[model samples]
Target: MGFHGIAKAVCRALTVRQDGPSLYDVCDPLLLKYQGGDPHLGKFYRTALGNPALRPLLRRTGLPALKDAERLTRLRAALTAARDDAAPDWTAIGTPVAELMDDIDVRHPQPPAAKVTARAPAMADIDRAIRVCGAHLLRSFARNGFIPTYAAFNLLGDADISGREMLMALTGLNARGYKNSTLLFALARIFIAHSPARALINPPWRGIAEPMWEPVQIRHRSAYYDAFFTEALLGFVETGLASSDQAGAARRAISDMVEFCLKTSAEEVPSHDGSTVNVITALAPGPHPRFSRFFAQIKQDLGFGIYVPDCDTTACAFSAATQAGADDPILDQPLVDFYRGYQVRAGANEPRVTVPLNDHIDYEGGVVTWIDNLNGDRPYGNDLDPTLNLDILEVSFRNLKRWKIIETPQRLQTVHRIIAFQRRLVESGAFKNPRSHIYYLPELYSAYFGRCYAAFVALPLAAQRIIDPGNVFALIRARVLGYVKDELIAHEMNPFDAALALMALAHLNAEIATFTPALHCIVQNLGEGGRRGPYKAYEWNKMKTPTRILVGGPEVTSAFALMSLALARRRMAHS
Candidate 1:
């Protein structure tokens, strides 16, 4: 047999254990004729294949051990199959309606001997902090008006994805749903944040505008965050934050974002009818390599780019465009159809296709993260995230209401299904556990949930009729008060977390005292010169690994701080 044949037989013979990473994972590239993609593993595999001594050892002993291990894994899974497939008790998580109104305080008890040192920030301090933060944000804006987002190695890495920083800053500023008139200066500073991204959509601003500085890992300027930028800009427009000319610019940016989403579909997949269709239903986190033909070749050869579209970005795009009055009927059906097709209905399909699963069936009705070109064989694409599903619920409702799109039975069914999924997911307290979410920290998840709930509730009573809010408000309360509030009182949260907490509390209309600590946290963290905070605001997960990328240094943190402090000021003045 040839070397390729021997490699395939060896891989097949290799044993994979149910409990851990296996030789199969290591040898998959050889069997599949694709590169492993992991740099460390790639090096190891090359050595194993080339070294004659290693090859002899692998053939003589390694293959049999691998075969035995695979057999054991299969046998163990078969033994637990019956117990694992049983559905979780969804009703058991439901709280009594009466109890939902009752406040459950879980504040940590402080020692009596300890003096009360942390005071609510004074009004003047808050105002000054806001000004300082706004100034910091303005200064952080690159020449092209983009805010830098960094990741942490030992400290924060270099400007990783500025688009994300801009989005988070804008989201924090508008968290209270305040009019743009009140935040004119801050808004003006951010008005051009989207321009660099928009320029990427229709380029040749090459000489005129400096491209946003990003690490080589981030290929496209849009890079999975255009929807977020689109939504942020649209928020400015709706809140009268943008002037006529600015609004026109915002709309143009929004158009570019939506068009980019539609045109970029990773690759085509075979439709149910056997004809191939561009899998354009969702927006991908891109490394599209549109700027250079060289990187495109690398992407094709090494599979370095994230080619699959995700539901979260797609939902953001839909809501942003719909609200911005960019009506595109062509996008509607495929999007609805993609969700319907990819939404999980049974056991984790294609186990060990990417990550290993131990026969759990809890993720029914939640849309999988990726809409890939795998047709029915989407093993890697079937991961479920409650946070992303909640995003879908929030954006879908907004889009439907804005366009007055006639909802299909399938569409309504999807709405009900994901809502059910979210309710059960939250009520079971799984949502509170950081392990349950793939991409977000628990506090971040709760903050987003609060923001989403507030937006949904604000939809006019007529528009709110589409999906029942059910116990979402109660869930938010439980999460914020029972869990998040305790964490705030006990721990020193970063400015980003504090800002998120402050806005969520504001949304809840909780007593000013409930979030004053968060406000104080933001105020006290202001670095000398008040240009930025002493801390970082956000840290993004790199592919859900332990290694986190710290996003937004002092400047980004200050942006969030400025917004939070401004909101606190407004609330305090009223009080």
Candidate 2:
């Protein structure tokens, strides 16, 4: 009988329920009809039913023992003949079934026996990484008057630093000497380019005007850029880094950008509405009370919760809620809903849930063309969205605890689910594939995976139960360490990936010894003008190779490198 027929027969014979308690439950209704008419068949069915779990095994293994009266008589005569001849030949029954049985056994083999060792990093190693990365940044500044937008490119090229990248660069050079001055001058050039006549600050993409800096255009402009720059500029004014005129200009620009973003209708605002909400929330507590009002208004219009249409939107919402305040239902509901939406029931338990980071495509698209949204509510599967999902989990865990959004039991359960999902992905070798998610290139996989590892380490102790319930932590730790050893140490590391890897190691409190070689590699690869090499390449055609495209300029690379080193230094100090 075919497997389906066998399943039906077995289900009927065993009185098993269809759509039973668990996913493994199997049933059908025909065998009972045969059993009612024949005592012999009923007796055979009772003997063959065996274990509930093993019952399905017979379908694939075949029913060699099951025989009609005619077959049984023939088998008995053959056996008698063989016994008389003193040569029992079983080959006449059928080809040997041992090979098939062996294949079945192999199909469900045990998990691997490999154990991963976690290495502790030393303070000296961290210090060395910081020193090397810092020295590299200084070297680049000495070679070029201004940092190139990309580590590998000469001049600014097509890339320009966003306000957020600029802010990070400024933060990195806050106390440094001549390098600080160069950074300030670079900031001044940007301010000059975005003067009233140019009107580049609030536009979709701002380009640096020629002569002073590279003439480069930035697209997908939004209020977030303005808010980030405003925050940075105001910081400069507070530190007395900016002159009176510069401060005045910054204040005016901040006011204008805020007005532009808030006054415009939601329909009128650029595509990334979630980003707009996040930027506004980020500015809420900082010199802009109006930001809070705008945040509330947007939330009211969009409804209470993280935008489910995309992972970035959900992540941004979680981040905004965490930053907003404590016990605020408006901000907290979205996170709670988001967590609930992605939770999947596991095993026989209703409460036992797992958070699988599944991908959802919002639209289809070309490189430069906008992704067409044929169906906004539907989410098709892809391999790349999991990175952002993990990102959301990381931010959610940190903020939810800090803000006390949910109860302890619920929070722990959510954390456990996230960890389980991550462990399954890593063990299944999904991370090894270079599938494109948001970015066009496969190289971004490592960067996102690095971030996922960082998130794993950032979880609280209750949420990080890898030893008792499972050794998921050790497995993830091994994979992360291996990633750093392979991608960061063995190969040339890009600033973005390097930054992410460094942050992951720091978060895990991994031995600085493990990452020192990777840090050194980054230092060695530092191009002229305080930059790193081979920016992320994006392409439209699947068959065509993508060109190395620089993003956010030298400031981004330098900022990330400095931030990584700084994080390492801070961790070492505390340790």
The runs of at least 3 residues in candidate 2 whose Cα sits more than 4 Å from the true structure, single-residue gaps closed, are: 1-217, 222-309, 320-330, 334-336, 342-384, 402-416, 436-460, 466-468, 521-553, 572-575
1-575 per-residue lDDT for model 2 (tens digits): 34565455555434433221111111113222232232322222232233243344222321222224454344334323322333323233111211111221101111122223245345455444444434433343345422223111111111223332223223322122211222222322222232221122112211111111123212222333332233333333343334476556545544554443333211111132232121122122222323235434432332221212333333443443333222333343334333433344443222221111122221111011111122232112211343544555555655655545355565555656665666665676555443323322223334444454555556666655531168775786677667655544444344445555666676566776665644553454445342243222111111100111223444334445555556566655565
Best by TM-score: 1
Assess each prediction's global lDDT (C-alpha) against the native.
0.46, 0.36
TM-score of each: 0.57, 0.41
* Shift of residue 136 alpha carbon in model 2, Å: 15
- As for candidate 1, its clashing pairs are 14-66, 15-66, 15-67, 151-157, 151-550, 152-550
lDDT of 2: 0.36
TM-score between candidate 2 and the true structure: 0.41
Off by over 4 Å in 1: 1-119, 122-220, 230-303, 323-325, 328-334, 347-361, 374-381, 402-407, 462-466, 469-473, 527-537, 545-575
Counting clashing residue pairs in each candidate, in order, gives 6, 12
After aligning candidate 1 to the native by TM-score, how far in Å is the CA of 385 from where it should be?
1.1
